[model samples]
Target: MNWKIIFCFTLLSMLETSSSSKIYNVDPSGYVLYCPCMGRFGNQADHFLGSLAFAKALDRTLALPPWVEYRYGEPKSVQVPFTTYFKIEPLESFHKVMPMEDFMEQIAPTVWPPGNRTVFCYMPRGNPDSESCNAKEGNPFGPFWDTFDVDFNRSVFYGPLNYDVIHHNMGDAWRDKYSSEDYPVLAFTGAPASFPVQEENRRLHRYLEWSDDIDQRAEEFIRNALPKGAFIGIHLRNGPDWERACEHIDSTPSLFAAAQCLGYRNEYGRATQEMCLPSRETILQQTRKAIKDYSAKSIFVASDSDHMIDELKKEFKRMNVSVHRMPNPVPQVDLAILGRSNYFIANCISSFSAFAKRERDIKGIPSGFWAFPQKPQNIQNSSSRSDEL
Candidate 1:
């Protein structure tokens, strides 16, 4: 027997053993993947939170996609990264986060079998005539693929996906099914509305918390712009689009009683303004009440329309309360400031406002939806509004 040949055989056997052990040690949870699909920061944030909750329920890894560029006519180049806008470390212990490119190029193919990728559409559980879903189909946001310039369908699981309708009754089933799947990769599309509202909010508080930069900027703005006292944060969601939405709720004031707006569908076939958008009078009244009740010396206003901000400034000034608005406000900055407020007045239908409220809830700060008729004394007992569309 050749001694050199014997030594080579032994080395080969050891290498094979090591590889087998490593393959067995790979964690299934690490293979779980999620790609966020939606428009704007608020909608994307909702999708992120919903995906995060689903990931938590099933113990899957969430691949944070680049922010959707819904504002531009089409999905342009993604300049911002996920960690830039949100804190990823808080969720690292329980779930994993990865770049969309890595998930698409490296992880997805290995985990999911060919032609078996799953797409979970996050629409309202039971409502067939959901406007948000319709809008998503009509006006698709984000680039087709995770990595720029790649063929969307080929790069990842993109096609007529096998739709798993996620509604109130379907969460547990989906979780169990996904958890038991043999494949390593699981892909989801649409905005996040799979879990129950309360569960989603709890998870949102945990994962969607802002990054330190956002936190620092918000604090600096508050320190410099706001007076030295408790402040109220108000989300005045009024604009041409919202104004039209308000008409959906104009005839149905009863629907405004709840924190989450729900009622008959509008022309767009989704929740009407009656369910989400409050009247201007209602906004003004609520702001005044919030200021007085919370004993706030200043008010921070986040609005889509500059006209609305100016009006709030004059109105708040008349009431002898200082008004603060971000100069050329961005969504993340506005949200950060709103979260730090002593008391938060959220727009009933706006996901943007809902995001802030969730942050405040995590911090044990009080918040209320402007459209909620029955104002609660404390935030913990706040109205049960469905923030997701």
Candidate 2:
């Protein structure tokens, strides 16, 4: 009755389907996985936008990392989801994105097991003899990856290359070197984008809208603490650490986040102590000018240290302007309020300031750096690309 032939056909069908079985839970297009373990929230946000652009350029889905936080009481840094502070839809409008927690839960088991995952880096970042990516050796690196129970057993050194993914042929380089068919996930030890952020990616900040909670907190602060009319928002970086850093500004031409304001090529004049840590007088003078220009009725100051709110209050008394700051300040809330201000002034050398500055720039709102443009001629050119980021 041809029973043997029927059995053979059945066996052949089983083998064919087994051969096509999916090895990865993710798509063949692959995923761009990275830790936003660079700096504070502002720096992380900067790197995040660049990473988003990188993923879009490579046509890969980005694993959105949590915002790393180092609070006062916490011994180790806390990992907060990207969605905790910002909405995901705006990021998806640019390209595909998935929260890191989701990727770990749904995809990691099939594509990247704890034993087989490899850490990718631009080049050797650890000891020369070790010649490893050393993905989890440091503070946020260890805490950030550990939060998702991720452990990389091997390292892939990808260079004579840099993360100038916008200008250079970096997408091609990455795709050619690490094909999705072979490597389902390219998990970078750090962000796969340039620091100080690329000028091309500056406009990407517009997509980073705050979550409902963050926006609500900011709105509540504005309604309760600030005056009724338009207000001038200013970010002051005068913490003990910032004060120490500003002391060396004379010797260092290129410092943290200065490239965002001074121009990556220094076309907008080099950074100065005045720009990094403006005096109380300088702050008052600039606040006065901004208030006059925007007809602001109040001032909102966000600072890392004791910003002397009383002194500011006294200085603005004659002008009939009120000064305010949060009782227990939240940086995200501060940034959200800053973005909503009629005018914003921020430090040239601070990444926190850079965050607000970039956001305002995207909204076509006026933004000025503290103690910048010492000469009238130093004003940034309206058409110059250097004016960006």
Candidate 3:
């Protein structure tokens, strides 16, 4: 053969190999896809940890779903990549994880082609006559799938069966029901995890390392903005919406993510108005005690509504305990800073607070709920040396 002909053929073969390599990277065992289409960041984060464990138990590659954000002035939900706030490297040590966007761009075409996609759920939702999964029927659900240009051709209502992979038999049940060879992709309408999160999966928070940018910003804020001495970080969930929810706190044994503080068995304490929406006086009282007990020189407040930072500053002014809050709050940075604090007191019924509380627990840092355990003296004691907080 002529040398010129040989060169053209070699180049063409190399191009073909490059295209094939992308498909080869796909896991032969299949994939686990889901939409973090629930509440805001905290709820999604809690579900994510459980879903991560679920994927490992099934021996499938977990597709890391994006963090669905609802920005002001934006009519539709914004899907931020899972890697936007966290590092995947730490997570991979636990199980195989690939960003959903990466899978959609590279592996999806080969493994899950268009017109063949199926949405999986516990059962058909909405109309009784209809057998639709209605996966993309809600706010974040529709936006989340749209982000990936994903449209399901069918729905799989794999019910009477659930996503409780805690028991060894549950995993066996799943494997027995749906084999990887037959069902290559298990795309869930929502996260395959429970709310308030399971006790076993809560420990998985260790694998969720913040992105370098978020970590650096938190460190810099602490070093430059906060006072020289140790600071107490606190989360307050007292928005208008919280006020409405707190109305039934008496009847509600556990509200929102109270399980993180109250314990799943309620061994700690049931949810209280003080824990859900503490009065300003109560907050001040708790803050003062935290400062005195921990010898904290400053306070950093994270909240959904107005954090009353000015009020805190005025009260603590005489004591010279500096008070602060993020100038432009980024939720991930707030959690990172809270996790690094000397001590943390958080809203017992807020999932947002649960994220920080869980992080502090994993690091052996003391954390407490606003007025939980009902006694001021027992606040620090109850939280001391316990990961349950």
Q: Name the top lDDT candidate.
A: 3
Tell me each candidate's TM-score. 0.68, 0.88, 0.90
> After superposition on all CA atoms, what RMSD does each candidate show versus the true structure?
9.1, 7.3, 5.6
Per TM-score, the best of the predicted structures is: 3
lDDT value, candidate 2, whole model: 0.81
Clashing pairs in 1: 111-184, 111-185, 131-270, 245-273, 249-274, 260-385, 260-386
- Please identify model 3 stretches exceeding 4 Å from their true place: 1-24, 375-389
Query: Model 2, 233-262: lDDT tens per residue?
Result: 999888887788777766665677777776
Give candidate 2 regions above 4 Å deviation: 1-25, 376-389
**TM-score attained by model 2:** 0.88
Error of 2 at 155 (Å): 0.9
Task: Tell me the whole-model lDDT of each prediction, alpha carbons only.
Answer: 0.58, 0.81, 0.83
lDDT of 1 at 209: 65
Residue 69, candidate 1: alpha-carbon lDDT: 48
Worst 10 residues of 1 by lDDT: 262-271
lDDT of 3 by residue, 110-192 (tens): 68999999889887877756898888887878888999889999988889787788865677788888888788899999898
